[model samples]
Target chain A: MEKAEILGPAGNLSSLKAAVDAGADVVYLGFNDSTNARNFEGLNFTEDDLREGIEYLRGKGKKFYLAINTFPQASNFKDWENSVDKAVTLGADALILANTGVLKYASEKYPTTRLHLSVQASASNYEAINFYKKHFNIKRVILPRVLTTGEIRTISENTDVELEAFILGGLCINIEGRCYLSSYVTGASTNTEGACSPSRFVDFSPTDGGGMTISLNKITLNRLSAGEKSPYPTCCKGRYLTSDGELSYAMEEPESLNALSLIPDLIEAGVSALKIEGRQRTKSYVGTVTGILREAVDSYYVNPASFAVKKEWTEKTRETFEGTSSTLGSYAGK
Target chain B: MRDKMELTLGPILFEWERSEVLDFYKAALTLPVDTVYIGEVVCVKKRSLTIKDIETIGKDLEQAGKKVVLSTLAIVSNEEELELVRELSKLGFSIEANDASALKIAKDAGRTIFAGPHIKTYNKHDAFFLESIGVKNICLPVELPKESIKDIAQNTNLKYEVFAFGKIPLAFSWRCYTERTYGLSKSECAWHCKDHPEGIDLRADTKENGKKAAPIFTINGTSILSGKNLSLLEFTEDLRDTKVDALRISPQYKDTGEVIKIFRDKINGKINYKDSSERLQALIKKPLTNGYYNDKAGMEFLEINDILNV
Candidate 1:
């Protein structure tokens, strides 16, 4: 069996260092700007941080991937182009991008640099993935969190381009590249603006019934009883009245994507890399996930027949799972 | 003068009965709009219409003096659906591809293709790439601000279209929200989507004494759209000021001819922007929103006066 890369997310210098130490084959991070999806405060790297981080990774014999993944508006075109130029100048290994325009520009201007399609592009099937690969020379596609493990196996068989599957993190119920629920509520689009459930527009108020009602831009997203864990108020997970007029979790229950149990199957299906999806997380998260996945991958390869998933593996990672709920997501959906 | 700008009716995102669709387009064929797009672009499982029904409707709509276009699914999952895409491309009209998979197949078939908004072409480079690959016309995404549309239109030679009316398509998913909401499996559900012709509205509860629950989203099968409809009636002239070739009207479950007429009159300068917008507003049930055109939240409604000065 070929070795699969354990890719980790780096929110800052500490997380980058932690990933390297924890056995990350490659670390993907973003600069401190709206171009990155996790454009949160006190997160992401500065120019100097990126420069030194690249040096540190090079010295350690690991790779750095720049995530200039947000879609650029016409007014922000120059900024996206400049970031592509900067990534190459800094000796970054590859760029994970979403916008079709940005991909075309990078493929034309810097032909040698590797371009990985971001999950935001939502290329689920072989033909869509091949379209990106054929037109832009995209080297890899980070599959959306909406496919089954069997589906991934079929797609890998059809396409020669590399496939990067999300192993663990906050799972988006709606496909990442197409969703605009956050933009409707807060004027921040995941596709165009790179902010979904932007924290700035969220407001909390004490309900008269003794629970708290969470609202985004004044529309109550959810009302939680005291001690009820408040999951991220994504529009898809929110309870809505159905056509039969019943209010329930209309799309999905709030959960985290944890593929630790399917590591052997995913690898056997020909995934070239496993991606850990949290650039907004703390260093502890980056370190812990990288370590667990590293161990799991190594053990599975060292003795494929003897390898079994230990309960402790999921228990350790479930500490950070969303709403204390974990799922294989569309990879194992009903 | 630029030849009277075309008004095209986009594919219906709802799952309507065959009779309802045929009658709706029967009326739509005589409307002020110059083109009528006929096909099922949403769930392939919604078999309310057969290949024969589509063929008859396509022939009837063409005979009724409207240019007909067949649209492909926004997301293709299996080989059967890909085969369906090729079948649609072979039909005697231009193909409107909502997914790149369909785009590639259409290009291979040497069909005249129009790119759908789901392609997410944001700038001149992407638009030019679409043109390079045999797309004759491209509908810009619903979430794009006006400046992006203006830039792409000005910089590219490809004909462009904007969502002039109806609910904005926000996302597409394989899991059906309606089936899950009803606690029924995908195969077991008894066509509940037909009940919600305009889609089920999702509202946010409010604590304010005088406020109503704000309708935030509408789910019609696999496509999730804005609860409020998007209208560019107030800015038809402004859109025309740019290089935009046409304004696309995504059909709601209403008598669309009246809405299409309002847009045509507004574009022809027969009615003032305010009066036409007021009339158009009176026809649709949902609150009107045009925030995306002005770089605000998509569910927001801003006036021409407010966005023009910016």
Candidate 2:
């Protein structure tokens, strides 16, 4: 079997270099516009910055993928169309798209540029996966973090397109790109606006008891005890009073998903790429996770029969997340 | 075109008893709703209604000269569910694909389809693609503003539907929030969602002191819906003028029949926008919002607040 490609998030220029230098075979980045999922400030590349990043990746013999995955609103779809055109001009290896209009336009205008279905499209089964492969002729699909490894294996067996599974980082409590929770709370959405719990709508207040409360759009979402690292106020992870009036994390815990131990299993399931989910993290995190994943994949390919996750591999990445705990998530949840 | 706008009752989102489910449809038989979307669209585990049961209901509804649409799950992640969607498509009714996977099966089987909101038909290209396929109608996503809905509704020859009432479905996930809230797994969830027939309320405080406020969201199995139901009773004129074929009312746990009557009156011009909007509030006991119909935050009533940093 061919060695699985290790993909990393390229939030900015330094992060792009961090991912490439740390041995990422492919790096996915979004433009400065709010057309992609990680609509954060100072996080994505300007058009010029994207060109520079592509040049850098080409110099290192690596691949570049542009994610223009947000659904364009009806009144102003020109921006999304323009972004797809720019990505094709930059010679991106593939375009990770979610919108129907954007995907159709890209396939027709830039016939040579390959297209990869974004996880935001929420194509979880062979039928949906193959629909894109047949209609848009999608070369790859980034599976939403909702399927078990067995289900992944089954879909891979049924569909011809390459499968990319998320191996590390934050998990969307709701299925990718289908969620309206953030927009309900703060008027930002992963599907339409390419943002979830955007920082600009967040406000932190110090309580009289020395605890801090994080609110989105003047609504208290989560409260942290003193000295605790206050996480982003994503609505799904927020602690709220349940039906019986118990204050708890009613929707989901603020835990990131870690699937490192499933590397060999995923590879055997015919998944061609392993993607890390953080496109909003700093360069240190982008670099370290990319480096660790690179080592793990390389070592697995060297000795596939006796592959195992090393103790050092777990230790080196322990503090990368806030909770220091990870979940196998739907991979095992099913 | 008909003298009145078509009224569609969306899928039953809550897990009611089998008897209650049957009774809801029987009562709906008399309501002014033209189309009733039957079948499971929320979680696969909700056993209140089965494909066989929906087929039975479809037969009765069809005999009564009403339209039936079998709605598919919003997040279809496995093969067994795909098998179910495939089977449902051939049940002698139009298929409403809440998931894109559902669309594929319906298309392959040569069935007429209604592209639900989860399919994300945002532009003319999406509309054209669905038209090329067997899809005859596309339900616009709930968050679209009046201008955006008009942009497509007027431009495309395809029929369109708008979510006119009920708690707006916000998101869906693999892990059931109703089960997870009680420290139960999805498989072992024990149907805790049935206890909150309307859904467990979620409140986000307006002040920093962590004070109590009205519920802002509701947790029902894997589905998260708005705390308050969305009522577009006031927008009937504009919707009809724009040639929207249907006004979808998501099935609520209570007063669904009453809500349907209110919209029906509004559509026929028997009631003015202000009078009907006020009557809708009396039927459903929660705050109402039309912010999404206007270009503003979804939960806000009129988006009177400043666009703080957004």
Which residue pairs clash within candidate 1?
A: none
Error of 1 at B304 (Å): 3.3
Q: Model 2 over residues A251-326: C-alpha lDDT tens digits? A: 7777877788999888888899999988899899999989999999999989888888888878766678765467
Model-by-model DockQ, in order: 0.61, 0.70
Cα deviation of B282, candidate 1, in Å: 2.7
Compose the digit string of candidate 2's lDDT tens values, residues B80-162.
Answer: 78878988988878899988888888877788899998888877778988887778999988888787788888888988999
The candidate that achieves the highest TM-score relative to the unseen native structure = 2
Computed on C-alpha atoms, the DockQ of candidate 1 is: 0.61
Chain B, candidate 2: TM-score: 0.93
Chain B TM-score for candidate 1:
0.95
lDDT of 1 by residue, B1-310 (tens): 7666789999989988778887887787678887778776777778778777777888888888888888888767667667788888877688888888888888888888999878788888788878888888988988888888999999988888898888888887867876766677554667888888888888765534686565788888877889888898888777887878889999988857888889898888899987887888777755789998888988899877876752
lDDT of 1 by residue, A8-31 (tens): 999999999999999999999988
Clash tally, candidates in order: 0, 0
> Evaluated with lDDT, which candidate comes out highest?
2
